[model samples]
Target: MTKIKICGITRLSDALESCRAGADALGFNFSSLSPRAITPERAKEIIEKLPPFVASTGIFVDQSPEEINAICRFCKLQIAQLHSEQYSPEDARAITEAKVIKVFRPEENFAVEEVFAFAEKSGINAFLFDAYRPDMAGGTGETIRASLATRIFNALGDSCYPILAGGLNESNIGEAIRSLQPYGVDTASGVECEPGIKDPVKIKAFIQAVRKTVF
Candidate 1:
């Protein structure tokens, strides 16, 4: 099954709603640059109320390994999603707690070998593919071609889970899943009334759509 991850959660209400709506994972952006960014204390509050089996992911960009690990500990996160290309594999492996998921922001010039190179990183549990924007790391609402996503999947070939994100909503999610066959799909702006705010109706529809889809 293609797991559902609702990203850019800013409120406990949004977090609980997405979880109640059947999201497999929830992303809490700790990156200062993100509009949807949340403090470790705030993320912890929401995480504590969450039911078991639902993963809470901490999104970090360009932070030191120690800082990331510390925040993960503080929040009791189950996953750490490293979003910076500047973050070395060594940095990823240094994380002691939560499993690491390194993101790949691929542009038109992106290469499959780049995916292989990042895959060589130790301690990474999965890889998430997102659209690359020159001005930002992710959550740009631009999507990578599923063909590109598919190519990377073929290369990785179950060595690790491949997750797809970027511009995904209820309308296009089915086609995106059908094409990439990713282990998961993440959405932030796609299911929101605006950045940092989620629409409950969209959230339910999105999850229902993912439920209806099959690889």
Candidate 2:
């Protein structure tokens, strides 16, 4: 089954709704640069109310390993999704509080070897692939090319867990899953009424679509 992650959660209501709708994880954006950014206090409040078996993930951009670990500890986050190119594999290894999920925005000519190196060197097995935007660090809602994504999956094989993101919604998720066969799928804007706010109907529909899809 493709694990489903509902991202950009800013409210406890949205978090709970996502959980009820069958999301395996909830992503909280902590990067102040993002429009969906949430404070650590606010994210923690929502996370604390969540039921067991649901993972709480934090989206970070360019923060030091120490800062990431601090926030992870404070918020009790289960996973840390790093969105900066500045972070070397060493930096990912330094984060001790949570599992690291390095985000990669692969372009048309992206090198799969670079991803292999990052995962092998950092000893991190989880990764999220998003659309490449020169001025943005994900949540762009632009889809990554299917050919390139397939190349990545073929190269990585069983070495890493790949989560597909970028522009995923109820209508196209089935096709994306069938083509890429990712270990998981993540969405923010795809199921949202706007940044930081989720539409319950879209959330339910997206999750249901993912659940019905077969790789």
Candidate 3:
């Protein structure tokens, strides 16, 4: 099954709704730069209430390995999604508290070999591909061009688990899944009524759309 991750969760109500709507994972934005950013204490409270089998992911941008690991342990996070370019392969390897997912903001003609090499060097298996924005680290609401995403998926094959992000919603999510066939799909602004707020109806529709395509 293709995984569905509802990212930028700010409220326990929104987190519970996403899980009830069939999200396999929920992302808590820990980056202060993001509008959806939540405090570690708040995140921990929400995570504690989540049902079992649903993964909790902490999104980090520009934090050190030590800081990321500390937050993961505190919140009991199952995954640490690193969204910064500053992290070296060594930094990724150093995150011991939870599984690491390195985010890549790739352009149309990015080198696939570079990504594959990084995965091998970092020993990271899961990667997230989000649209590249000049001033933001994801949550751009811009779609990665189908041709570019499909090309990367084909080049990498099963070497890494690629999760597609950026500009995904109920209307176009099915088409996006059919094109890229990613291991997972992540959405932040896509299913939101506004930044940091989720719309339950949109969340349900979005997941339903993805399921229809995957099965």
Q: Judged by TM-score, which candidate is best?
A: 2
Residue 49 accuracy (lDDT) in model 1:
93
TM-score versus the correct structure, for each prediction: 0.96, 0.98, 0.98
Q: Write model 1 residue lDDT over 1-215, tens digit each, in one string.
A: 88999999899999989988999999999988899989999999999999898999999996898998899899999899989888788888898888999898976667777666666857565889898887987789888877776677777777788899989999999988887788999999989998999999999999999999987
Best by lDDT: 2
| Candidate 1 TM-score, true structure as reference | 0.96
Q: Candidate 3 residues 95-189, lDDT tens each?
A: 99999999889887799887888898999999999999989998999988888888888888888899999899989888888877789999999
The clash count of every prediction, one per candidate, is 0, 0, 0
Alpha carbon RMSD to native, model 3: 0.9
Ranking by lDDT: 2, 3, 1
What tens digits encode model 2's per-residue C-alpha lDDT throughout 105-136? 99888898998899889999999999999999
- Estimate every model's Cα lDDT from 0 to 1: 0.88, 0.94, 0.92
Candidate 3: list runs displaced more than 4 Å. none
Q: At residue 110, what lDDT does model 3 achieve?
A: 93
Better of 2 and 3 by TM-score: 2
